[model samples]
Target: MTQIVILAAGMGSRLGRSLPKPLTELADGRTIMQQQFDNIRFAFGSNAQVTIVVGYKLEHIIEAFPEASFVYNEQYDQTNTSKSLMRALQASAPGGVLWMNGDVVFDPMALERAAALVAREQSFVSVNTAKVSDEEVKYTTTAEGYIKELSKAVVGGHGEAVGINYVSRDDKATLLRQLKRVGDQDYFERGIELAIEEDGLRFEPVDISDLYAVEIDFAEDLERANLFV
Candidate 1:
């Protein structure tokens, strides 16, 4: 069974309100985090053991996904994703796992593509490439489709990361160790770069252009996520 980790432990201060970012509303009358959890639940079924890392307003998240295993990151406000994910990765124990950001909104097709790659035992990323406008998030790539760099900028002409990652058991272990090496200053993205450089873990970028993925950080993005519902 593939263990999926959803990192929802952040305090979204930039959202400019007290409500936890994940618990924010969508057009479908479900919270953003709830919608994502429901989608994942559908994709993986009971075999899909989900571990959600929560910190800010943790109780609300707990009540929302009672079936999911929970790991609280006490330092969620002080730390970055590298640390939170490192902690969640620890509690997850030994296994092949998929890491996803709690904030991204997308259709099940993206999850399907990720599952396909995992079924093949490959390390890959789901990305949006065809909509390579200036506003799109960036993911640098190699000729063979491996991501060489990733960010909102330097996004090559064709690919942008969709905030979903498939990891094998070995890769997961390696990533955890790298996470330990990352200082308190780093975020998850830094760990990804380190994994690629230090461990030769080339994340294969799987293009899913037709699918839309909205990452809600600010109020405007939250409003944008409404379109998906």
Candidate 2:
């Protein structure tokens, strides 16, 4: 069974939404979170265990996805993805967790690629090599082509880490340790970078750029993503 987590605790003020960002309705008539759930069910089948970390307007998400397990992040307003992810991992069972930023809108094939990686028990950061936005989470690989630097501040980045990622069962403990070590305001990538630097965690950059994957942060991004939907 694949253990999946969605970080949906932020207010997503950038998107100007009164509701949770994951609940944003797309052109296809399904909300972003619903599409993510459907994509997971498609790739991982019925046994996939999904947990959502929620805070900002959590009630709407709970009402929409009542069957999903939830972990509340009371400090969501003060922290970032690192802390929200920490909460999920703390409550998780002994297994690798496949997780994504709640706002990503991607082709279903993306999760199929993710599912394949999970089956191999490979730790990875799903990447889109086609676009390397300076403002997005960028990554540079080691000589062995494993992820070396991963953050928005990366220099000469080869591509962007598209936010779909996994921690293998073996690396789970190490990642959790680093996540705890990260500051409250740091994104989860900081924890991964620390794990790689301090404990030598290997995270492969799985390229899924041929397939469409958009992280909805603004109205323009949502508009572009809707074209794929």
Candidate 3:
């Protein structure tokens, strides 16, 4: 069983919208959450357990995704993405977990490629090596191709980490423990970096450079996403 966790707790104030980011309507007329669900089902099958982490107008998410499991981050305003992700991970069952950010819209084939690696019992971070942007979460790889450093501060790195990753059941406990040790203000990637550094959690880099994926953080990103859709 592969559990899917979506972090949707942020207010997305950068988008200049009152509605929660996940509920924002895409150019296709489907909500961002709906598009994610559809893409997940298409790539991973309908039986995959989808758990959404909601806050900042959680009622809208609940009403929209009644069939899916949910974990509420009551302190959404006070915390960052790390807290919302931790809540979802704590609520997940024992299995491979596919974690994604709610504001991202990606090609389904990119997920399929990542899922295939997960099926091989390998945890990985999705990256688009074709282009690296300063605004995105950049990453650097070791000589052996393992993620050596992952952060926005990395300059001229291999590529930007698309906000999607897979953690195997075997590595879940270690990753969760690392996540718990981090401060609430940190991004979940901080925990992931710690897990790699301390616990020897090896995350292979899955390059989906040819695929289309966009993280809708600002108005321009939303415009790009609309063009992609």
Q: How do the candidates rank by lDDT, highest first?
A: 2, 3, 1
* TM-score of each model, paired residue for residue: 0.91, 0.99, 0.97
Backbone clashes in candidate 3 total 0
**Mind sharing the TM-score for model 3?**
0.97
What are the per-model C-alpha RMSD values against the true structure?
A: 2.1, 0.6, 1.1
State the lDDT at 205 in candidate 1: 85
Which parts of model 2 have CA positions greater than 4 angstroms off?
none
- State which candidate has the highest TM-score: 2
User: Candidate 2 lDDT, tens digit per residue, 120-220?
Assistant: 99999999999888799999999999999999999999999989999999999999999999999999999999999999999999999899999999999
Top lDDT prediction, candidate number: 2
lDDT of each: 0.79, 0.94, 0.88
Encode model 3's per-residue lDDT on 76-183: one tens digit a residue: 998988888888888888787999999998888887898788789888999999888887789988778988788888877989999999888899898889888889
Question: Candidate 1 versus the native: TM-score?
Answer: 0.91
Find the 10 residues in a row with the least total lDDT in model 2. 111-120
lDDT of 1 by residue, 93-117 (tens): 6767788888887787788777888
Output candidate 2 Cα RMSD: 0.6
